[model samples]
Target: LWWCPTGLLTLLPLHAAGYPDPADTPAGRTVLDRVVSSYTPTLRALARARKADAPATADRRLLAVSLPEPPPGGVALSPLPGARAEAAFFERAMPGSHTLRVGDAATHATVTADLRTHAYAHFACHGSQDVNDPSTGALYLWDKPLTVLDVAELDLAHAELAYLSACHTAVGGATLPDEAIHLAAALQLAGYRHVIATLWTVGDRTAVDVATSVYTSLVDGAGLDLADTAHVLHRTVRALRDADPRDPTRWAPYIHSGA
Candidate 1:
């Protein structure tokens, strides 16, 4: 598991914090080079969050949200043109899932209510991380933001996985990293078994590719085992890393948490 140090340590990659390669081979070159890493806000939270295992594939139901436009009075966030594409990809990739896209159709009330019934969820939109109070962090919905505090108030007993294709959903406060105050952790606290989140602002197009690869692997039985999601992510990220080894920013920001 990974835990980034709060405060000045945010610049470091705690998950990839090891030393030189082992003499034997390339296995231990770095913490990231070998490990199938996962992140958590705190050790206790991690333990609590793993109380339940991910549900079976047959039982999975997805709720996908994609907001390409910034809300009224909110500055343009470089329109995530890929958001619609991501949603459509999932609808076809994971057939029989519910999708709430840009329009008068997806609202804060509808999205939150849908959370309780769905086993999995995906969000492709702009995200805001509240530096002073990480708990106030949120992912933009059609009408408003689904704040971390708001997520914590829900009881999602059937929730199995959540993929936040937005920015900084996994980032915690620089002062209190162990407090588990961000949106990803808040979803865990609300009973989600697994969450895939970003550590910082990520490339919009890259985010879509990662999400596509992940869901496709999870649904296509011929691909990697969905039961071993960490391994699935490891392979996916490694492929992305191999494509452009120089840009760690693209692949490194996405991390899986929980079982």
Candidate 2:
């Protein structure tokens, strides 16, 4: 079982703890480099937007944090949402003094604290699915993991944006009969204005790069509308792979925005 690196660390390795030498491996380096480039500007734009939106005297700020490693190849990574990108993505995406909360599942208390306090949240992990059964849809964590039902229970009010970098969190269109099993739709109805999710089983590696970059763009208003966000991400990932339409999986499957 091999797990990939993504999330904030997808942009910065040094700032990210628990993870190995992400830049040391060829695949790791390529992902890190792409995420760093895509999110650098997005981060700046987000800070500017946040600053203007903040009320005078409000101490609103940005905070990016992550665990150590990705899921071990064949094993589940704790069944909670966790991002694996570079930490720089956060440092740059949200400028100004930021809080850093680093810990494994052993420190579930740490992750819980940050989620309750942070304004932005990013979760990149293995998202389980069975379009026929969303109750089964869950985010895999490296250590401490809260189930999807648990996520539904937690009041994610302070958090403005949640990037669900997982696979098939939203893929229950014609397949299911009763109700669609779309994570984004469910989250939005739950009061989340911006919810970034996948429409199908995206390549873990490709999802790592595409989601990190797109989320960055959305943060900066490059594609505020969910529809635009989905299009830009689909096109960007395909462009990276050279637009090989012959290979559907290479340039297809991954879709988002409006269900």
Scored by CA lDDT, what does every candidate get? 0.74, 0.45
Candidate 1 matches the true fold with a TM-score of 0.86
Which one is best on TM-score?
1
Off by over 4 Å in 2: 1-84, 92-113, 157-159, 173-178, 219-242
Q: Write the residue-wise lDDT of candidate 2 on 42-149 in tens digits.
A: 233333323333212232343444543554454545433224343445556655545544334414456556656655555555566654455556555545443445
Best by lDDT: 1
RMSD of each candidate relative to the true structure: 3.5, 13.2
Per-residue accuracy of model 1 over 187-223 as CA lDDT, tens digit each: 8778876788887889988988898888777874312
TM-score of each: 0.86, 0.56
In candidate 1, residue 11 scores what lDDT?
Answer: 34
